[model samples]
Target: MVEALLEARNVVKQYGTVRALQGTDFSAYAGTVTALIGDNGAGKSTLVKCLSGVAMPDGGEIFLDGQRILLDSPTSAQRLGIETVYQDLALAYDLDAAANLYLGRELRRPGLLGMLGVLDKAAMRNGGAGALANLGVRLPAADAPVGSLSGGQRQSIAVARAVAWASRVIFMDEPTAALGVVQRERVLEVIRRVRDSGVAVVLISHNMPEVLAVADRIEVLRLGRRVARFAAGDVDVEDLVGAMTGALEASALGANDVEANDVEAGAQTGGEGNTNGGNGR
Candidate 1:
């Protein structure tokens, strides 16, 4: 496999009374949707916070293109070309799509007006509109307040904004949650579009079918640890549910254990069990 675009190794995070992450390891590859799934309280949220620089991990190494780096704040992550769309959407309710897109990184007029805090609305609007159109997201209008848009449209804005500025990775937290079936499908299509554009995507979702349908690979977290990583096409919903419920430890494999077992099984079975070899189940 190619080196991961973003990686977290042996990451640990803890609150005073709760240990949120326990030596967790995660990675995102360019042009793939890596779905992170786990039961509630399984530390998915904690891991996301750490990865997006919303919170600092107590200990661990985070790497970008194999180089260790620090992500102490959301701004830090953004500067590194990592953007996160939180579950809350994180937009100003009254702001238009373009305004929300350029919330903190707004364009200003040249020279004196720029120094006087004059924003270049036309430039920002054009940029935001272009981004949305490029991503194939349909919205009523780019200048309409986000609060006035439908659930899917609002989600699309959030995703489009992330895609516009994100050059390396995008973290999406339950992007289709609480939406209608159509809206969910639209969001899924947008996710595929993003991945196809060659940006690494880390999706945190509880929807099993969505994960199975959209993810290239799936990582399951159990009790603050990554218990299994599976190639999406190699596993079924039953397998995923089993891993989540602790009913199928046989299929749960770490990076090294997977290869080791495949080799052992191949030797024992005269290479017949090797059919699924290299599938990374």
Candidate 2:
């Protein structure tokens, strides 16, 4: 069997009396979009944080390319070709799109001017434009400040930045949370382009229609662990909701069987997973 490009096994996370993740397992393959969906307190955000290196798991292992790896910090994850686009779409409102794309990884000029920390603005502008263009994102003005752009454009810039740097896996949390129909479709197009580039795209979303529209595979989380897995073509919104709420029997789903321990752990939590740790989904 081909190993997943990224995988998590028996992952656990705790927040002082509340367990956010209880031996959760996850996997993402290259050249595919894997949707991670769950209800509000299902530990989606916590798992993303652990995988993206924002926080360390209290227990369990994470693997990249089938090799066990440690993600101690966000920078460490970035070095390993892992990037995340959070819902807030962290961008400098005062800076132009080009500047925001190269916010931290700025290109520098060669020679003494480079030594003096001079940024290659023109190169970045051209490169940023190219990157956005490659993803089918068209801005009204390349030089326009991100603050002045529409919500969709800003979201696209955030995705573009992640795509420009990510070579292995990209985790997008709620990429299309709030947007008009056109903008949402545009961002979904960019996601398709990224997936086609052979990078594993792990999408965290609550929009069932959007998830079914874009995801090749779907993993359902309940409480803090995976309850079901399905090929997007095999399930509908009802199935997804059933998995998330534990309304349907895991064994009857004909998907991956839910582990017994995970179900028990979830029961022990009494649905307090989201509130105790400030680990809101």
Give lDDT tens digits, candidate 1, residues 178-256. 6789778877888898899899999999999999999998887777777777788888888888777668764343332
Clashes of each: 0, 0
Compared with the true structure, what per-residue lDDT tens digits does model 2 show for residues 33-106? 99999999899999999999999887777889988888988889999999999889989999999999998889
Residue-level lDDT for 143 in candidate 1: 75
lDDT of 2 at 40: 95
Worst 10 residues of 2 by lDDT: 272-281
| Deviation of model 1 at 22, angstroms | 1.0
**Candidate topping TM-score:** 2
Estimate every model's Cα lDDT from 0 to 1: 0.81, 0.85
Q: Which stretches of candidate 1 lie over 4 Å from their true place?
A: 250-281
